[model samples]
Target chain A: MTINKTWLAGFVGIAALGLAAPALGQDKPDNLTIISHRVHQTVSTGEQGGDITKDWQDANGVGVEWVTLDTGALHERLFRELQLPETNIDIAFLLNTRAVDSVTKLLEPFDEHMAANPVENIDDIFPGLRAAMTFDGTLYGIPFRHASSCFHYNQRILDERGVAPPKTIEEMIEAARQLTFTRDDGTKVYGFLINGEGYANTVDLARAWDGDFITLDYHVATTDEGMMKAVTLLHDFYEEGILPSNWAAIKDEEVNNWMQTGRAAMSLNSCGRNRIFNDPEKSQEAGNIKTVAIPVSEAFKDKFDVAPAKVEFWTMVIPANAKHKDLAWDLVKTMVSPENTLKAALNGNGPVRASTYDSAEMKNQLPYADEEKAVLLVGRVPLPPFDNAAKASDIFVEELQAAVLGMKSPEDAMASVQKRVTPLLPQ
Target chain B: MGRRFIYLLMAAPVQVLLLAVIGMPAIYVLWLSLHKTAFGQVPEFVGLANYGFVLSDPYFWRAFVNTFVVVNIVVYVELGLAVLMATLFASGMPFRRLLISIVIAPYAVSEVIAVVIWKYMLEPDVGPVSAILASLGLPELAWTTDRWAAMTMVALLSIWLHLPFSFLILYSARIGLPKDLYESAATDGASAFDRFRYITVPLLMPAILVALMFRYVFAFRLFAEVWLLTGGGPARQTEVLATYLYRHAFRYQEFGVASAIGWLMVLATLLIASGYLRAMYKRMLTGDA
Candidate 1:
């Protein structure tokens, strides 16, 4: 009877041990899955596909499963996965503005994560980007590709016209008009190129003029008198032929072509696009491209105090359903380490860190690095978690385009957009 | 009883697949359309508020009209061109194989690739079409900005990509057509045109209906061309039902409204397709054209 009891005890112990083994195995994932739009360009193509990830794994003794998608599709996937109780996405890079909409729901607040896994140069990220990544006083993201807008121009054309870069909106208009010219062969050249069709397009100009398009409280500020003035100014530009004839339909890639081919003397484009202008293989007027801060409308600025430049950025966030938060955080830390972040800025899109602009390699690569950094100092992103921001943006852009297309007067368009957006704002 | 049981077992996998793939999603979409559900928020039963919003919205009406007009233009134009080409090919044109291969090339390329090519070709300054127009003293065509011009461009592209499919079906039907009817019509003092109008039209009705139905469904779901070329822009002039649905679902995160729009689209297609099916059934029952 004593021997039988001892055998029973041993059997129970073995059964308990068997049940715990699989649970222990699942405690750590072999590799983490990260999804982002630029993952392919930054990770796979950064150093011939697997070399970069392999090197990082070798150094840190970990592995990753990186997935790349287009920006629209990536967001769709993020939204779907976030709704699931168990998700495959361990980490993702989201637009900094989008993080506001997902904070504390789809994403885990990173204040604790950052504290537990301290990364060097975490404090060196640009203040605008850091603030943009924070929601309700909780940090939910780490800045990745934070870029600000700037006025880019063909320096050779400006020099030939004997006009310096414009410092005010009036000067910009005057310069653009003067720059429009016809050659001896009767080939007409455009003075300005504007991407008039995106969600962020005319809103920037309105914000510059009125100090706000939509207030932080989600009120309709686009119908303000000052904002209408900005709209009229753009309409005047269109009427005077200062902008391209197809300006009402132009998108971002067209602006790149116009600037690179030296057809447009000036353009308002993202500062990160400076890399394209600097690439000789891709640009026809590589050495002649230069950038400056977006000019302010002083008449409007005199009435309200706000930043002159508009900005937008992207950030990395860990999902709430992530299986390996520590490993994901460690990967983020390693990827954004001082040395790797610099490498990322050089290879991929914009840099997130202030030190990146100040680096020797960045200076060598980007001729207008200082101007880009200066723009960041005064740049402002539209505060997000604005109730239904995407919908509001679409409504505003549609009306703005109607004004641009001469279908409606500027005042009418602004009023129409305001009326439509009023009900959408948070009560 | 044993045979019946074996038959049910044999069909079980397919029924399960149909349930998982189609039945569940359709039911889910119906459920979603009746509720006001935002991402991260619990669904609230709204009882057709979404459908009401879709029906009342001016943008939805605009998109519906645009989809109807664009789909009709694409399908009819594609059908006419395919019939003409197929008739010619069947009547013994030189290098018929090569001509057919060339007509089918656009279908081989992916939609995105085809759109990219067309986008470059339509560019105002650098595209060859623009240069030719410039040389001819014509204004640069605002293919994307002008409402009618953008719609025409999209229709033209749709016809090009789908022409091959229509052509192949009609051509095969033409080849399978009985030759004795033509010979008898000729013997009775019928011209080529008469023979074609009487016999070929009646016999090819079946194929034509098939081609039209297929093309109508494909053209109704037009997204890639408009998205890549104009992005439903320049004041939403070229917005179609599919792109509109896409914006509400993906961009705006309003899946409930999108589902409502989607069901409306399905209903519209069903109503149109019902006419064709009824006609087809009549033709089958009467054994007439």
Candidate 2:
């Protein structure tokens, strides 16, 4: 039903007033605002945020205020506000997926920013990281944090069992079998546990078998024999009762708990988990945990001729409607500056820059720095550079999980996934 | 005329709020459903394409079937238990007040907390429930791994969550029954079971129908509990429409397809609700006439 013009005008007037009230009180330029999703401790702690904000104020001669939120919440907020012509966000810290998906439309390209700040030493950043931040030959993000999947095992358990950490897929399975036991109470203990419910889990398992869900050409690639092998290998873990029956519900934190309690002998976890082991308050198995590259199948070993390391990176980007785009770039430059990047690396939770890794500070901080470096060299990141990595991963993982649970055979699960995902892949 | 104008003036605010909050979004979603859009791209007009795509999708059909199965299981179980408990309470059992309070306690806990509590209880190694089963010499079951078992576990949780509301409504309806009917039934040599079947059951049907409708809707939209508990895993065997739509819209960012699926869900819910309302209306009219 159409309303009278007078009533509509009155309603519009009230909304206008409501919208105008917030804008009336702002002295816009004196303050630099940065909207970031790194609300958790390694990024925005009392020490970290305070130090960064103080340094930013010194560098830019402005009163800088930082607003922090979790990743998902920040995306919702930024997506809404940035749709408007003038967003208040000067800078944003988002993950690689969001940056790639939303950057061209929702964010301004960072090439101009980098070009203007040539003295920022952007070249010194790792090439893999730089490539990760670029989409369609234009820079969209600056790398901030890097992660890789590594096998975190209990040294005490392995030593007691007279077994060494597995370096190949077959050895890993044998070790997993050896570690499993059933108690008199009929409670079955596991040797290895990984998330079997989602795409990330499948991708982790697929890496060992050299399977790719989507190939570099961006086609559905899960119907291959290698993918089947990967699915079967994971299924065998469950079929043999070497992995927890509740692996589908298992989360990263739960995996950490299993390792810390010495309940599981091994888990494929992010390298950042090392910090948890080093923290006396959090870890029961501190000083007894060792990290190594994930085991590879014989075929993958021959193909890459090295142990496969699964590399993951986190990036920060500015939204298109950011009020202070220049200021945001300044913040990005400062945060990723060699000195600060090195500080973050030494603190055990930042991106791996070439300079940061070779620095004496990092060496002093990480006890296993040499071993970590060796593993990092051979790390393999997921390919195809699709914006739907998270969703694709979820589907892949769920399908693999079906195989693991014996609901579907490896071939059947992969075939089903191919049918579903093929249509969604970018041409 | 002046009085009518005043009434219009008074109602305009609510009408405008409803239009802005509900009507506009519904229209927007409908518009979106008829388009084609991929991640990081502008939408293009594609009349009926998304609907066609959704209709042909196996995942959509699977999720639709799963939703119905879950709804049916949860509703029937919850209704039976709720009616029984209400009758026992209506019979003036001892500690009626305490029993009523205890029966309604599960409603106080949020769905997430309920799922989390159950998850721990059903854990393979440390869960007390699994331990109990093992002690009883029963084969240890992976509650979230086996497809049928996972669906059953989710249905069980759904019923558990809806039980308190169903019981409260049925109990109130039972309490409201005419005292003379029960007296007449007892005097007529009606057995306890006969009294329940003849008097209590008939009287509670209205409340039961309402309770059933509410439970059906709640069980149909089940997402958080399922997501946190199983994440629709073991190969999407436990996936319902809501979780499937979520994966499409947010995770896949296929907004057009997601919107189409959403409209399909709305249509399905409407059809189910209409059937329910019609059945209840017919029952009510026939019983009264």
Candidate 3:
């Protein structure tokens, strides 16, 4: 049915009126608008909307406003708000992967703030996570939480197969080959499930395979031998049916679902996912799952003397154009303070503060605390900071998908990625 | 003159609304196209550099080609199918009301929801259709991975969701034709085919053109169906102009390039649409069948 003109007119009028009015908490002194995910709700003293801000205000004697968006839109929202400072969002909790490039253009350097008002136990933050929040030797953001890709496997499935947790890429592949089969009930169970849908997962595997697809200087090494091997290995898995036919379409949530429902014996998932697997309510494999360090690519095995896992972080930053930068830093300080970091850890966010891991409450709450802490020490950023990181990743993933689907050879795919990516990098 | 003034007064709100919604944005897009802007950076006036860059990019050109091809296919197929169904309905089929509702149901489903449903149904491993094919000892084709398969799937889904709108327009037009004309044709020794071709074809041309023009513009701006399905993937084979523009604007943060792409799309759409109108106008003037 067509929309009635009367109804349309009324709706538009109401919308215009609402837009004309100032938002509910815009005018108050010390009232800061923060953009972040609702995961911050986990750190709030009270339940529901603005509770974290209220709690922060009560504790620190300041007024604050909190707004949230999905993870996909957070970077775009933060970038837009920073560009248009009139939006009045003073602070943002953003992914560090995006923040690294955004810091110089959109965020204020916190070196001066750190010098003036040093956060207690700031040194206790994991070096990898702290490094992720820093750009060009100047700290741009404070670590809020960090997640690293790790090996999560169903122990019962492994035990039934009489296989050990894989420590190397070759061993993992062999185990996957052996464990993949259909059961008597005609249920198809796969051996390995990886979130191989995007660049992050591809980069994780590339790093493990010793493919220096990205250099320390933010140059694309897409055609590197190790990168080719990495792509080829994943393609081989797809070709051999060791992975599901729909592996190219699998995402993080599906990996979780596969692990939770025991459809897969092993999967490369995240520390945050381990929290879900350990929860009896959310997972059928609860108490039967185990977390191990991610297996390195056989080609790159020599480089991983310490056996590093892929690490990424979520951080809080003050925008350079923020009207109340100092207050924003104060809020950031409070949010990343040792006490609050511990609170975030307890909320199922991967702890960034080393001290938080030492807490008895953390030990009690996190079943994989030991594995996570160990991995954090060796966790590495798979892709370094660059201005065109997002675009570059998109190009890489497209080529990676082509290779995985046998649309292009590994060499050809990497060449395509390299050709596209070179133009995006700095001259 | 007084009545004209009253008409102007009546039209003022709509005129202003159109100006604000369409005219201003159209002008701003042209202005934005001349600048070099990325998210979080100050826009720099670059004087046609964005247009130069977009035009020179191979992927942009590919997207442009894909947009034209996919849109033309969807429009013609949908129009053909819609005209056939409308004619059948006008022929007095049984359960006409029920059939009409069933046809219109797809239109009621939101594009995003419909695309999601189609994506799941076509998914290779877990989808019921794929399972049934597998059970029949058929190969499980990777719908999103194969370029032609991906494009065809997106086009089919687009037609499925949008056919109802076109069908409804044509159906209404078909039913509105004078019944006495057909009676006269029958009396003149016209067969059913002859009656349709001689009477229905000429009369229904207006509705067909309208539906074609509407679907042309609509399909030309396709993004969600293809993007959600394959993300212009399997090596960007299914990428369309709109999705390409979105990549530049949002994902790549190149607002200037995106604006340039937007203006290009508008121009291309106008040229195609006007060509249709030009033919229709010539047909009208020439009294061509």
Candidate 4:
């Protein structure tokens, strides 16, 4: 009886071990998953092909997964996941400002990786993009996409009003006033709609004003007269009732929709605005839209030959705790290659590679390639890197919204932002 | 003996599920509240600093006040409307089932869908409601811009989302009330209003308290509706404590401060709930038990 019981116990123990094996195996991390803010549609479609993720996996020979979320959702998820030490995010793409503020500590600096496998002909990449991707003299990310601010106008509207797209700030304002009209129902249509609410747009507006958030040293708020002038210009539009009362709530898609629907004659948008105007399915007035350099201030014109056009870039980075950092970097390499960059640009992303922009295929696919090339030449990089960018932007956007909503004067709003943001700056 | 064993066997899974799902998480959250940690960072012992920070911050206090105001308005409005409707239904009014079903329809709609619908209607331009108001020759009121109006809008939306649940609870309580008391009150020449006030209200107090507690707690952490609508905008005027916690923890990535704020909120909630329970206990003991 004792011998029989011992054999039965051994059999039961072996069965238990067999069941536990799969659980142990499941707990081990295998595939690396990259989370980014770029939508799948932005990365793949039509001639670009919709299987970029599959292509990435095939090329890299790694078990990989890709997920795309919007910018805000991506930030929230990254922050939340990073709080848990066991999170499985192998790589992440963050807005430059967010990288600086939140994920800087979570990132593994890329200096070692860049040294190990330097891209051949690295100098061919845009200098501004390279600078934007560098933080504290170490590369934390690689620039994946970029856009510079430009004025997008409805050629049809301008022709109807017998006005040209303004070449200077004064002329732009004048044309805006002239284009304003009142319908029989008494609802007024704006000639221009400035994104007066958020810091994303205000950065471009600040460029026009020649204002720097961080001084030339990139360490403090400049608070120059030009920044104040930009703020004042926006305030004046709101005061004159030329701006929408819903301006505070307007998002990028809404702005694009408004411009495309002929609700506004001209608006300041990024270089990507060209893509929107050319999209046949999305734009109602597709063929009629044209791009030009944003009008310059007289003060800015003396210092800068062109309008204070700004260059901005989005980058991808691998997290410090990434289980598959090597694989993640490989994917980044593949996605950012000149060939893939051209594919991404064709699919609607602003390409970071100069060679891609200069390629015959890109020029053929993108109708306004020449106009874009002209605008790119004059574009200046925004003063500070994009990391922790949203914090400064949050303050600026709040102040702008406050001024636009008539809660505070432009001067007070600017002062408040300066006071709030100055303390957060690095000592 | 076999039947008893089978009964215990049947209940084992349910008991284990309760312990795993509810008891474990509740204990874990309590433990987390006691520690200081950043995202992807290990927790360090911080006895009560998080709680202290939350208590001292003016923003926390402001959010706390806003939460109370919103919760009070929503609860009182919903309770009043729900109890009246319940009483009407209990009175066997015409089309009572139809009225109840129609009233519960909004509650059946998910919070996200309800907020989305309301957002479109409240949009300053291109919204039919706004258009109608304009046609009435009224000044286009920035309903979402002003502080009081924004808070009211949130409360109104909360009330709409919660009306069906509140009504169902109170309606069932009304229907289940012992009929002998109503008959006795009528024999004593008690008017309909007097009977409802002296007897029906007293008898339904327990149910009302339960409904009030549910609405109050839910409103305190009201996130999605506020986030989707105003984004706590106009200078964070509409921001509640929960939204403030979320902004700090996620948006700003200030996990230390956020954790501290979170623990303090938990403490405040516990204290308020305890106080409520104590009062209810006192009332229960003092009343005709």
Q: Count the backbone clashes (under 3 Å) in each candidate.
A: 0, 4, 1, 13
Model 1: DockQ against the native?
0.45
**Per-residue lDDT of candidate 2, residues A1-427 (tens digit):** 3568878998999999899866643423677666665542355334532354467776566776677787777776767676777877776666655654454467778888877874267777666667766667888878777677767777887887788878787788788888788656754557787755545545655767767677656777687765677678778887888877788778777877777767787877776677786466887788788876677787677765334555667766777867667766776788788777765664456545666667776777666565555556655466546666666677777777777878788888888888877766665
Candidate 2 clashing pairs, residues 3+ apart or interchain: A107-A320, A198-A397, A199-A393, A199-A397
TM-score of each candidate structure, all chains considered together:
0.88, 0.88, 0.89, 0.83
The fnat scores of all predictions, in order, read 0.54, 0.70, 0.56, 0.32
lDDT tens digits, residues A1-427, model 1?
A: 9999999999999999899878765556677788988653464337421233456666655577778899878876887788888787888988765764544467888888777878786878778777777767888878777667777888898898898887677787788898888766755668877787874546556555644567656667767865686677778878887776667667788889878887788877787787787579999999898876666777755643333466787777888887777778877777777676777766754776778889887888777788777767666676455537788888878888788668899889989988998887666
TM-score-based ranking, best first?
A: 3, 1, 2, 4
Residue B139 displacement (Å), model 2: 3.0
Regions more than 4 Å wrong, model 2: A1-28, A40-50, A167-170, A183-187, A205-211, A215-229, A277-286, A295-306, A346-348, A415-423, B1-17, B37-41, B279-289
Off by more than 4 A, model 1: A1-33, A39-65, A86-90, A113-123, A184-186, A206-210, A298-307, A323-349, B1-20, B125-142
lDDT of 2 by residue, B206-256 (tens): 788888888777777889877888888766777889999998887777889
- lDDT tens readout by residue for model 3, A58-108: 865667667888887877777777777465778888776676564465778
Q: For candidate 4, write residues A301-391 as lDDT tens digits.
A: 7766556567776777787866656667766676777667777777777777667768888888766676555556556566564334456
lDDT of 3 by residue, B126-244 (tens): 67778888899997666666767777787899999999989999999999999999999999999999988889888999788888888998999999997777778866777899899
* lDDT tens digits, residue span B1-289, model 1: 9999999999999999999999999989999999887767678899989999999999999888888999999999999999888888988999988898999998899989988888777777567878888899998778756887888889988999989999999999999999898889999999988987998888999989888887777788899988877788878888999999999988787879999998999899988888888787778677766
> What is the lDDT for B32 in model 1?
95
Candidate 2 residue B106 C-alpha distance from true site, Å: 1.1
The residue-level lDDT of candidate 1 at B193 comes to 89
| Full-model lDDT, candidate 1 | 0.78
